[model samples]
Target chain A: MKSDFYEFFCPVKVISGRQALSNLPHEMDQLNVKRALVVTDKGVAGAGLIRYVEDAFQGSACSIGHIFDETPPDSSNVVVNQVAELFKQKNCDCFVAVGGGSCIDTAKGANIVVTEQTDDLMKFRGAERLKKAMKPLLVVPTTAGTGSEVTLVAVISNVQAGVKMAFTSDRLYPNVAILDPKMTMTMPPKITAATGMDALTHAVEAYYCLQKNPISDSLAITAIKLAMGNLVKCVENGKDEDARLAMANSSLIAGIAFSNSMVGVVHALAHATGGVCHVPHGVANAILLPFGMENNLAKRAGEIGELAQYLCGREIPGDDRAKAEAAIQAVRDINKKLNQMSGLPNRLRDAGVTEDKLEAIAKVAVNDGALIYNPEEVTYEEALEILRRAF
Target chain B: MSQSSNKNDSRGLDSGGLAAAGASAASIYPKAKEPLGMNRLFSLSYPVKRGIARVALLALGAGFEYLSRHCDKLKEEISGWEEGRIFALSILSQGPSVTMKKENGAIRCVGEDLKNAEIVFYFKNIDSALMLFAGFIGAHTASAQHRTIVHGDIGIAMEALRAMNIVQSYLYPGLVLKKTFKRAPKMSFGEKILKAKLMLVLLPGIAAAARR
Candidate 1:
């Protein structure tokens, strides 16, 4: 299953298990960092999860220079600028991102600003365009979704311009990704369910996208299997350390897979929804995964059929097309189960996406860069249809 | 959420908004001194950007020439192809075009004349072309993204795509080939020797071409 020609790169050092957070100071010391700026939201700090990270730094050569716990749920250019200022003011030489995607991306954006000595990040937007390596960054993701830790791209909203500028580069990969069960054990079941589904969408899209290759496909399959086996258990009992660790590993694996291969219309549509209506990214992705899978079924039935067995835990009896439909149905069943367990909304309407905004979301989705990797050509009207169906 | 009427926002600059800024980037030489039609600012410094594109395109052309001469895959792909078959790879609405034509079963660069080109792959923007040359994105993915347009026979375009893929297999490292190609070839001992020979000659030839 080797592709004719393909390249795979993941330079991020990963450490996962109990008390993985304790290695953060040692990892930072290896990177020769002296002072670190910790980026997280008020919620993570309020939940006392940041205490573990703070405790990890005690007696280590690497010290916390500042704790900027003001990141909003949605990362913005303003937050990035503020974080950069804090880094400079505190004379921090490294970043410790200790929350979900927003905090991680905010640190990434600020890293670009400080290292590149530019106030504006938009100049570095797009793929592999940066010239200088970002300052050392280590991510400890509190949520088991978004995979922002290992991903090479960061999305920061520019509310003034009404656009979310995406910055991508090989240099953006965090120097280390530390996954600790204690960090995610405190997440509400709803957030847990939504983020786990986000990981699933990333895996499914990586397998079916145009950039699919053997290596990425292998990682994606493993991620899907892990998610299928552990996401529900983690949701049902958040304290189950094994389930939490598996889900964490699944999110990281899926992150690496999709970051290399890229995601498709599901991300495009979900990103647009997050932009227009302020829906949570994972929630939007969770609602739209089945609809997006159905849209791609025609061009990618063989891959979808294979996915059916991974998801449903049994061989489906049918042709490729029939099995693809069965895979889509398995996703729908999973969504319902998540809803029953954690009250995760299964439809756009339930997620608070107004009908009037579907057209706007469709318009933005068609222009998303993710559309380039989609198996099928998606038009604005067709995107609208998917939205309506998901609604 | 009030919209600002000012010409620029805090997100640095969008290519489309540059008309008001008085810094328009024109293509390299042999074309009009007008701004890039697609309006993307070249991210690299101008001298470095132009030099990189020139050398990369020259290497690509020389690689094709070498493949045409020594590679069996190339021969099989273009076997029975009529003479005077020309293909141009160009960024749409700009310069830096490279056209190659089949002459006596070998490929040679024909400069930037579209009239002789039966097939042309046009990048929608300068950014897209630069990204492709930088190996940041694959050709097939670029096409799917509407970043490219093919002008000519659909059948020939498909053939050209296959041929380009073959040349790429010989030119790029196995790792890059694995990333870019749908299926990377398993090279034989002779094929590996041929690729080594091609690289030895192609690198200097591209350097010479770029100097000119």
Candidate 2:
């Protein structure tokens, strides 16, 4: 459906396949990169997935200048500053972000600081603030989820301020995303299930959020179908290359979809919950997706109903309202199956959300920028109600 | 703002001499004779558009003052809000920002310069603001188009949006309200009297404020 006015853009050149990592050096040549800084977490390096990125650069003009593998699960501003300093010290011409969202976001934040020549990223926070073109960044996500390689926004936690600072600008989009299935093949069942569900949530929210338009709607539907078909198989059998590649594509497509259309209350609440209790982002989304949809059902029932068709692979038996309810049920069923198969958390309490912190989480959730894109207005009381229900 | 206006006036007129000459020779020039596209129409001398926006924001501020004083719904919605809570609605990098504050239990405009606004509603482009100021679209519709960004506490922003909706219900006609509001206000008999009373007080007050 067409809105009266809307804007959509995704400029990241995505290269996906079994041997896609081999194309990284050629892509680097396209970006005119020489020495590259490799950013990854200890977890990804431990899994030996960094080798795929390192090995891709062999026999090419571009070489890895330094490896900063200390990225935490939550990328922090302090870490970003350190990475930028290292990039400058090594005289690296580009960044090759490995691992998931945190590594990618750290590189993104560092890129802004390096190119803009600002020591404090706090001054350049918010949307469309960075005006200059950043150094070329090529992302090789070790996980199938987050899709951060293509996203134009980065969330880096400020350790001093105890807040997550989000940097959004067109300049943040990486020059290339090399999705090699081998990189994600090392993910365990639990991470696979959680990340898959996170991609599913992204597609679902993008399909029904206030910003939904024809282009995003089409991409979101395809992402939903791809994720629903491949997430379970990939979780059950991690070495299933086809399933891993499919889920990777789903995550990438869903990343593009939500990047343009944006997510709704689910992401808002999930972000707050993550900020408060340190829950992983994908697990929070996996826990809260259905509940978030239920909250918006009143205003977006017809749209939610349409998602049931994607999930069920057929027309659901009911009117728009009933189909919407069925869609909620379908999400619940998927959650249960994912939990049974891969031990993914199906409730907020299971995800370590304490009952006492619900009020605080609710207070913070209401302030998230994503709330502006929610289909229905969410008040504090309503946010608390959703938290309690999810709990 | 004035500095930017002077710069624009200089650039748009290509120095004062040509601008005066263009005004005099506007009828003879083919470029001047061309039908104005939407962008061209809005690209009127920046200072003039900026002036229109200032008046529109002031009028909107006065409208909020009336609604805050007379509308019981708005009062109830904003009840228990802090005394000095500030909000800013702006067109980013183009138009001026309008700041509003809660003073003496009602929201009123402070000035064009944004102070310590706890909440900010930003339009990414001036075209979005133009469409909205021209009443071609409503707040919810604008939001749907990804034309608005809320900075600061979103809960408080929603409350302010609700208050804006209440003000719109009273300020615009039923047809506009029907399109804009999810559930347009159905005023009771006493509420109708309150609306009438508020309008009687507002017209003179708005005129005075606009004049000043």
Candidate 3:
């Protein structure tokens, strides 16, 4: 059969340590750029991370354009266009994003306006649509997950259409991904857990993606191990730098895995929920994970059993049926610990999902592009069952 | 110690195997592997069964739950089967059987699983016998006797060659059997339906891989 896989990496220099924020200017100078545009939400802009970038660029060739700080939690196209207008007006040579997925995605969208000279997000919705590079984009995620800093995916929600338009292109990847745990130290435990679960879901889905190859499988396995070991610990103790750093690594690796292999029905369900009820993407995935894995388990018992062996860290002498269940139980154990530590809902009903909406949500999830790659066929009725279980 | 052929009467198995074994199997079908390839990977001795190729390729890693913890017998059954890790694995089979028509440099043979050769391995349960047939295909895939250009484009073919070399370096001696592609055995009604449904589940990956 023919293969349609394209692998590309964004060229970004990570200069991180205790004084990692101080390294940006020198790296920018080395890249030979004289001007920088600091893109972020007003909250982060007010926190003075932007000043660190400004102070570092004092004597170097780098200069800061006016900070575009009106970013929302879920940014809209208007905000992206507004930032792009500033990019052209200030003649900004590069972009420095000091926030989460939202800020970084805003910068990616704003870059399109600066170089591609168009604001149509629809034009670049599929693969390899943009053949050229955008201006140098730098992302420093304050949150430990959402590896937008290192990913080629730029997710933008078109609130008008109620669909999260996923704009994927190699050109959209940030040039530099600065992963400094200290940057994430200020996040609330809830925010940390939400993002961490998001990262964990990425790893889980990648491990099960039908297109997974040896390379992606290795990365997904490592990422999942990290998430299982550290996501909860970091959430419980916000000041623990080690756990924070581990989650950062987990998020980065999972991003790399899913970005290459794509995700499955968990993501398909999340996409539907996010589009319809405006649920946070990670929250939807967290609620559906065990259910989705169980449904896929009947047909894909072998792969699940292999994964179970890995999760158990040894071959447990038993029937394949028992082994597969053990692997899924491990996921539940992680979720249990995560909930105890982070305080997120264990079910959709707790997250405000109602039975009235289950059928519609399931129908939507069934049609999602991600469902086609699911380990098992999630017929329209099965999706509803998953929702009912979660609800 | 035994080259045994038990009736695969799924409806009756797991109970009184000795009494019910031969009644249905002997009259309805020929002996397995009359057209053998190798092992379950491919029994050239077995007649090319329906959709067997697709089931083997897609299910290369596809394992359903084991019915029992009795590993010794199962291992003995599959002991001769080639086992190794591969970079990327694919399976395809003929759709509903049809007359073969000569086309260009090759012949087009259509049937139950081959409806979509571009994504042949995506077919479902196909047949248990077919999985072994596909194993034979994978084993001989790089061998001279079964070597067919994996892809028409030079770059894709080169990639296949690279994968083949990697497989050779990392593979155990037993798994070399899958390289020789062969025809598979026929299937029961349940297996055929399962294979058809499973094919659609895998359809997305085909599109995704092609795009990549």
Candidate 4:
């Protein structure tokens, strides 16, 4: 279904290929920046992905000014302030985020702090609240799932308040996104599978969500086909650079799709599950996607059914409800395959969520901003029911 | 140069003729100095729409106050809000706004003042505001259409939206509710009576707020 009115914008310059990382310095030079701050986690740094980024800048005029590799799994306001201080102390002119969602979000948050010249990030926590243009940010996503590289939103946790602060604006998009297969080659099978499922969920939810439009719908279909074709191959053989690149492209495409169309109940529940039970976001998303689809089956059966061909790699011959159910079953089958191959959890219990936390998770889920774009209205009781079923 | 030819070249190009042409063009395509009929219509409708939105906001605020006292669901929804936390709904760019504050375990309409608001839900224009107020669209639809923006914590905004949904369920008729809500709310018989009572009080409440 098409929306009556919609707005879509993505200005990120994407450089993809085997040697996409080598274009980083030239990309920075195009932005008239000479110094860059590299934001990443210790995990990515330990995985030796930073070496590729360093190699990209070895002989270039643009240089890495500082490397802040202390980004936590959940980037926070304190961490953003710390990164901004480092960027200023080193006289950096740009940011090069080199990990997954957390690193990219940290760089985005830090960009807001540096550009707005504010140590307090809470004041700028909602949509289009930042009045200043952010510093140039170049992203090299080491994990393909989060797609923070192209998204115009960032979530930074406020440690003191124990609340996640979400900042959204067109300015949060990275100036460049480099998709190098070498960057993701080190991901283990389970992480790869989980992240791949996360990308799938993004594509599926974006296709059927309330904000869906023609452009996003096209991008979402492409993303779903790419993910369905390449995710398992990359998981089974981590060295398949072709499959890895395809999955990377899938994630990036899905990111663009969902960024415009927005996500729905799956992301709301996944965010809640991750916040309350400390579940990994990709795992939470993977576990909750089918249930979320089932929940929306009443309102969005035709749209969901349209996705059956892309998800199952074959046309499903049935009514909308039957095809929608088949599409959902395809998701469960993929989860089962991934679980057998890489032990990616397909149930909430296996993803470290206890039954006792379902109520708390539901409470948080109903308050998530993503719920506004959901096809079906998810009440507190409905959210609890979904959580209970997923568990 | 021939004086007669120069005079011919200048024909119909004198200052008076130029001014007449400009006026003719302005009548067809109005410039900054001349307001078009469409612009005049919009300008006239702007204040009327704003007035309607103002009253609707006041009525909504009043509904929140009333429902918080009587509606169990609304009371439960607002129980988690911090004391004195203020939120507002306004049209962008110097438009009329209504601020509501959480106090004494209930919501209070603080009139059109936006000061001390911890969060604000801004309609991008008066038309969007009127659409929502007139039950032509729901909050989620307006949000999904990007016709609205929030300036504070999104979580708190979502909570406020839930409360607003409850108020709208009572304020709007079942037919409008069915069209606007993602899923039309199912109200019990007592709740239907409460909705009727709310409708009875809403007019007087709007009149009272208009005086303020």
lDDT of 1: 0.83
Positional deviation of residue A267's Cα in model 1 after best superposition, in angstroms: 0.8
Worst 10 residues of 4 chain A by lDDT: A1-10
User: What are the per-residue Cα lDDT tens digits for candidate 4 across A92-199?
Assistant: 999999999999999999999999999999998899888787899999999989888989999999999988999899989999999999999999999999999999
TM-score of chain A, every prediction, order shown:
0.98, 0.98, 0.91, 0.99
The Cα error of candidate 4 at residue A165, in Å, is 0.5
Native-to-model Cα distance after best TM-score fit, residue A202 in candidate 2, in Å = 0.6
- For each candidate in the order shown, give its overall lDDT on alpha carbons: 0.83, 0.83, 0.60, 0.91
- Chain B of model 3: TM-score? 0.25
User: Candidate 4 — which residues are off by over 4 angstroms?
Assistant: B1-44
Interface RMSD of every candidate? 15.5, 9.4, 15.0, 8.3
Model 1 residue A55 distance off true place after TM-score fit, in angstroms: 1.0
For model 1, what is the alpha-carbon lDDT of residue A340?
99
- Candidate closest to the true structure, highest DockQ: 4
Chain B TM-score for the candidates in order: 0.75, 0.70, 0.25, 0.77
What DockQ does model 1 achieve? 0.04
Better of 3 and 4 by lDDT: 4
Task: List the TM-score for candidate 1's chain B.
Answer: 0.75
Score every model by TM-score.
0.69, 0.84, 0.64, 0.92
Q: After superposition, how far is residue A209 of candidate 2 from its true place, in Å?
A: 1.2
**Per-candidate clash tally:** 14, 0, 62, 0
- Per residue, candidate 1 scores C-alpha lDDT tens digits across B62-146 of 8887788889889887875689899978765754777889999888776667776867777766677776676655677676444
